[model samples]
Target: MEDEVVAEKTNRQVVEDEVAAEKTKRQALDSALRCLIQGQGGELPPNVAVGMNSLEGQSRKDGNT
Candidate 1:
């Protein structure tokens, strides 16, 4: 019983850490993208669409579309 409780606690902690890390990463990426977009002066970076398209394609292929 004690071992099971410890394992459950550890699993929960790991999930919490992963969620925190993902949130931090997303925030950082958003900040960087915002800076890039704002600094571009009404023109998007050339690779922006390409990158997005690639991600969209991957998502579509993965049935997440």
Candidate 2:
């Protein structure tokens, strides 16, 4: 049926969107880590640490432990 095909396409699009979002998040996290490493223990604005920690915990698997 046409409705079934539309529903399947919508589901696939949702999955693709999720994959794109996760990839963008990971790239942002990696960039942040590189910046921190280059900073070499310098004091960061408190929000920087908070942001990084939250991003670390944002995964579906809860691997931030």
Candidate 3:
């Protein structure tokens, strides 16, 4: 009865939260790809540029493999 209703609501909220998280994750990946494309041309969004620099540094430290 009331417990079933609460359970249904909880299940719906969990689904909504999962959808939101997946959307956010996809958006972040899309943005990173765009930044990488721009970086190939020597331009980058400031935030992504920092991450790219860090990645490049790490690659160099790992012997440029």
Candidate 3 structure quality by residue, lDDT tens digits, 1-65: 99999999999999988866765675577578877787789666799769856765764574542
List, residue by residue over 1-65, the lDDT tens digit for candidate 1. 99999999999999988866765675567557757887886655668757755755764564544
With a 3 Å backbone cut-off (N, CA, C), the pairs that clash in candidate 3 are none
Model 1, stretches more than 4 Å misplaced? 43-65
lDDT of each model, Cα atoms only? 0.70, 0.72, 0.72
RMSD of 3: 9.5
> Stretches of candidate 2 above 4 Å error?
41-65
lDDT of 2 by residue, 1-65 (tens): 99999999999999988877876778687677768766896655678768765665665344422
TM-score of 2: 0.61
lDDT of 1: 0.70
Candidate 3 runs further than 4 Å off: 42-65
